[model samples]
Target: MILEQAILNIKPEESIVFEKAFAEAQKIISSMPGFVNLDLLKCIEETDKYLLLVKWESIEDHTIGFRQSEKYNEWKQLLHHFYDPFPVVEHYETVISI
Candidate 1:
């Protein structure tokens, strides 16, 4: 599985609205192909920061399958505006697990 990670820095005081928008946006991503699961974690030290982790079957599943699909526009529309400078997304493969 490929793990997609992004550190989202929401606009000041917009976390609540972002969360609500994400609630709807999550449904869009969850319905896509190769989607395993996702978690949205809020930071304790920085309330405006959030960690988004999504598991996919392959990198293509997210880069091509999802990003290239029309659904991506919906996802962007719902949650993109909440970001300040925008987030950097990265993908990883597990090396070791207990």
Candidate 2:
């Protein structure tokens, strides 16, 4: 499995609006190929920050497959504007498990 992580820094006072938009965006991502699941976490100390953990079957599933699909355009339209300075996305593979 591939783990995609993004730390989203939303503008202050726009958290609720971003959450609603993100819900819609999540629906789009869920329908894509190789998509496993997603977890949205909010920082208690930094209310404007959020962490998105997305699981995919492979990196290509996200980079080449989903990003090239029309659904991604819609997803971008829905949630991209909410970011203050755009989040940096990174991927990881499980090295150890217990």
Best by lDDT: 1
When superposed on Cα atoms, how far off is each prediction in RMSD?
Answer: 0.4, 0.6
lDDT of 1 by residue, 1-98 (tens): 99999999999999999999999999999999999999999999999999999999999999999999999999999999999889999999999999
Highest-scoring model, TM-score: 1
User: What is the clash tally of candidate 1?
Assistant: 0
Q: Which stretches of candidate 1 lie above 4 Å from their native place?
A: none
> What would the TM-scores of all predictions be?
0.99, 0.97
How accurate locally is residue 28 in candidate 1, as Cα lDDT from 0 to 100?
98
lDDT of each: 0.98, 0.95
Count of backbone collisions within predicted model 2: 0
Q: What TM-score does prediction 2 earn?
A: 0.97
Q: Which stretches of candidate 2 lie over 4 Å from their true place?
A: none
